[model samples]
Target: MGQAIVVTSGKGGVGKTTTSANLGTALALLGHKVCMVDTDIGLRNLDVVMGLENRIVYDLVDVIEGRCRLEQALIKDKRFESLYLLPAAQTKDKDDVKPEQVKEIIGRIKQLFDFAIIDCPAGIEQGFRNAISGADRAIVVTTPEKSAVRDADRVIGKLHSEQIEEPKLVVNRIRPNMLKTGDMLSIDDICSVLQIDVIGIIPDDDYVIKASNNGEPIVINPQSKAALAYRNIARRILGDPVPLMSLEEKPGFVERIKKFFKLG
Candidate 1:
């Protein structure tokens, strides 16, 4: 059976949905069948990020409430045949879907793909519990900011309490300039605080905003730095020992030539 993984952030605006979208697309690009489930219910954005929003006919609520079959709610991506999206209900509240129903649907869908990535809603509440109900593993997404890291720490504690231990961390929107200037938390600092394995480090790329605006995942563009990081994370998720991307700014051609000649 396919493993269900939940991408969540205890605090909102930490790129959880973007992580979910890119990771799912990256996995599919790497040749795995992927089903991305948006469990945010009333605040779903995975479909929009994946550029599949206009194609959603039936949603997760429809499948669980018997309004539609599970297959009927799965929207396939033309770019990647292996990639599919199970959009969240636009009209339903978080409390409307029970944890059991979420688990049941995830369990049933696991048989259909290599990986089922669940995009969890922000905050720790009924929606959070429901999103992680059937997940085999969890990916806690956060930024380098103190608030996001603090929230991520609490989320790690909550996940362990819920019997889902060892959730990996993905530090998003890391700025090299900030790190160099001592204005942002370094990976070392964040890891010391959260004490979890760092699975991914996404740089703050302007392309991400452009991609979001155009309803496309950054991962689809291999040239994007954030895309490379997401792809590496997907490879790591598949048990590949992919090294994290270097966050240091690339040397200019002049600097490279100077270094080549052993000059300062």
Candidate 2:
């Protein structure tokens, strides 16, 4: 049976949607049948991030309400054959979805895809619970700021309460330079507080915004560092032993030279 994974963050604007979109695309590229569900309800953006906003005719709300078949609600990606998207209804409210309905839908999709990745809404409310109810695994996305870290801790607690064990952490928008200068929290710092295994570390790359604007996920670009991070996270999810990427804390050509040598 395929696993249902929920990509979530307690705080808003922590790159949860971006990570979900890219991870789904990366998993599809890795030859896995992947279905990404946007469970943000009314504030849907995964459709736009995956570049399928205009193609969405039927959405999650429609499927649960029996307005359309699951296949009809699913939008296939243009670039990856194994990739699909189940967008949320922007016209509906969060209360439109019940936790049981979301679980049933994900359970149905699990049989058809290798991975069902749910892009959870921010906060620990009804939308969040609905998104994570069916997930076998959970990935918490957070930044280095104090508020984000605090929210991550709360999320970990909630996951445990929900019987979701060891939900992995993904520290997004990390600036190595800031970390080195003591201006930001390092990966170690974040992990130390969260007390969970670090599954991915994504840098703050300008390419991410550029790719989002163009309606293409950075993971498809291949040349982007953030894309590489997302791909590594996918491999990790699949039980591959890819080494983690180094976040540049100190600004200089010395570390760059060392990184180059290591790559070579």
Q: For model 2, how does the per-residue alpha-carbon lDDT over 68-150 read when each residue is reduced to its tens digit?
A: 99999999998899999999999998888899999999999999999999999999999999999999999999999999999
lDDT of each: 0.94, 0.94
Clashing pairs in 1: none
TM-score of model number 1: 0.98
**Model 2 lDDT-worst window of ten:** 246-255
Error of 1 at 134 (Å): 0.7
RMSD of 2: 3.2
| CA shift of 234, model 2, Å | 0.4
Model 2, residue 220: C-alpha shift (Å): 1.4
Residue-level lDDT of model 1, residues 1-264, one tens digit each, is 899999998999999999999999999999999999999999999988878888989999999999989999999986899999999998999999999999999998899999999999999999999999999999999999999999999889989998998999999999999999999999999999899999999999999999998889999887799999999999999999988899988999998998989964
